[model samples]
Target: MTARTARAVDVPVAGGVLRVGVWDAAPDAPTILAVHGVTSSHLAWQLLAEELPGVRIVAPDLRGRGQSNAVAGPAGMAAHADDLAAVCAHLDIAPALVVAHSMGAFVAVVFAHRHPALVRRLLLVDGGLPLSAPADLSPDELVAAILGPTAARLSMRFADTAAYLRFWRDHPAFAADWSPELEDYLVYDLVPVADGGAALRPATSYATTVEDTVDMNTRPTVTEALDDLAVPTVLVTVPRGLQNETPGLYPPAHLAALLARYPAVEHVAWPEFNHYTVVLSRRGAARLAELVTAQLSLSVA
Candidate 1:
């Protein structure tokens, strides 16, 4: 396969610059801005970007991740939505469609809610609705159980880039279908650290983690925000999220309710996908692109 030329640019935002990746093809084609999950960067959409053709694809390294690490000021979805608005304005392209993965999906929903004028449609991959916790549990306990491993991974300063790639390969979710593109993604996500070592720079800080946990519980508010969303939207869910029973982790039921609430919402559940692979897997990426294309085609027709 020929390597497509990709460009990285930083667009100024409120507190800092938002790093954006452009997969430019045809200017007349519809534009799609990809919002990555928490602790993810523009590379999150690598596989999916490759599949989508003839479109101006904008993948922004959300605040505090990848090249956008400096724009970590936003504590919740609202803040991210605003940052996205700024980036869209900078690009001078109206929001064509938004395809968001995981936490990026949450930010995309909030963005569409806040700036309806910009978004023509929304494709939420394994995200969109907020996380939920048992009424009895404390947020601290929930976060530690659900996100502690991720926090630990980000904190690790790898001795070399290859070691980091190995770490991802050994992971339960990604081990089965690891590829060269994923290797490039892992390398891009890392930065050289002091003491002649490298580390993940877009590490989700404690503040951001806590903020996300809190925001996850704000599904009601997000629903209210989406109540009047004029833009069409779809939610794509993975099997792990629905079947896995890791305590303290957010459940898929919350997302179901959100889908039920919106007249314009559509939901798809793929049993073959895990939380991460829903956007990374070839089938999953094809499914995601198909959904977005189908929606856009319907709109244009």
Candidate 2:
């Protein structure tokens, strides 16, 4: 069966409401709580939703990103985890499988730990493992260095949506895998600035992005969750980083050590894809759908 168009919903939470994208399959179909990256919106799961027609996919535009950019209070792993729990409570889904990408993976880990009863499994895509950081850099500097161009774009202003699309079209990571779905995702990220001009700016808050980046690196919640992890988790890594460069976020040796420490966690490497393409590309989404479907079957068995 072909997937249906996604429906948007606003779920109330502490401080503000979270805008969620729902790909409803059936009333009783297995639910997957998908989460996007730091700079992404719920639309990131569009391709994945199409790949799994029998499963219901729910993704939220986390506070400080996408349509939920106005959410109040601080942005951190703990706060995000709490918000996710509230979302699950609002949806009334128990033991849901969570599929998270990039920084979303960090949030998923903490959510599984904080609300163990709400999550049955975790699918971490290209994130969640401890990253190597320079101890000398401050939080702000760390964020700048880690995010690179992705962070730089937040401070920039575009003449129009077309200009923003042009910028992304030139990006090394997305240039080769460009598609209408990706264009839609980028278009949704743009918000009109109030300078009495036609130019638009990114919806993501710079302060929130910096705060979350720092928290992801220094937060104890992620490490604590890993230490006491009881949920079955699978991590999928790509061979390229955000810039489409080789020696991706998790190097082979680094991942091997991480797996050794967390022996219960399963790891899979997709050499053909990159950090962004893992969920944005057709092949990558298909592979992820297979994993989600297999896990859903296990959950019911």
Candidate 3:
């Protein structure tokens, strides 16, 4: 679909239909199920999809985000995993190579564990393992602790799409990797909302964000899934974080400890990319494309 232009397909899920963006390849082509970050939509994988033109990438707007924003109820690792399972069943694609970014990585781990027959392997970009934080924090506290300004932005209403684009354009993480394609993804994030006047808001549900963020770091579903996980998996991290600050999501010591605990998951780092750029930027997406091709080779070999 990257070469032919992408299209949307809705698949029924828990509370509503999950909106999936399909990038076409020949029917016989290998498929990649890509999962985006906490607040991101399927469009986050557009660059990566285009890079691997020969691959059919099915990226879904996880319930409570993107076009699936109306999807209701619980939003945790297991819930997201089941939503993914529904998408795969709807497409009749089992044993697909799963490539997930940020919180999506957490979902993939559980998905693979719960539906081992469906996922062949995983390429987790920028997130999957737990972050360094107190285990006793509440979902709201955790969202504030982990997301910081990102969580704050969700409450801010914008006059129009241009204002939202400007908000991201000024972000330190994206300052150097900005592109028109990136703008399209940003625009898609906005949805009209009644906030005192004519205004727009990010489609991501803050309540869902809190629930999922808390579950990723504090709940046993993620860590337990990781403990029992047998699928072949690789985790790739960047040097910078969401705002392009040093150390990124997983600092050296924290990352080393995680690797020691889950030696089954291989680790790799990309010095030139940040958390967001690893999937949204051109050069970073090219590097990711190379990794996907290599993983597909391993899956077949």
Q: Tell me, by lDDT, which candidate is best.
A: 3
Worst 10 residues of 3 by lDDT: 1-10
Error of 1 at 64 (Å): 1.0
Off by over 4 Å in 3: 1-4, 195-197
Backbone clash total, candidate 1: 0
lDDT of 3 at 139: 73
Q: Give a tens-digit lDDT track for model 1, residues 46-87.
A: 777777766668888877777776664656788888888888
lDDT of all the models against the reference?
0.72, 0.89, 0.90
Q: What is the TM-score (0 to 1) of candidate 3?
A: 0.97
- What is the C-alpha lDDT profile of model 3 across 1-301, one tens digit per residue? 2444579999999898999999988888999999999999999988888888889989999988999999988989999999999999998987459999999999999998898889889999989888886667777888887887888888889999999988987899888899878999999999999545689999999988988888888779999999998989999999888878887899999999999999999999899998889999989888999999999989888
lDDT of 3 at 181: 82
Clashing residue pairs found in predicted model 2: none
The lDDT of model 1 is 0.72
Better of 1 and 2 by lDDT: 2
- Superpose all Cα atoms of candidate 2 onto the true structure and report the RMSD in Å to 1 decimal: 1.2
Q: After superposition, how far is residue 128 of candidate 2 from its true place, in Å?
A: 1.1
* Candidate 1 minimal-lDDT segment of 10 residues: 241-250
Order the candidates by TM-score, highest first — what do you get? 2, 3, 1
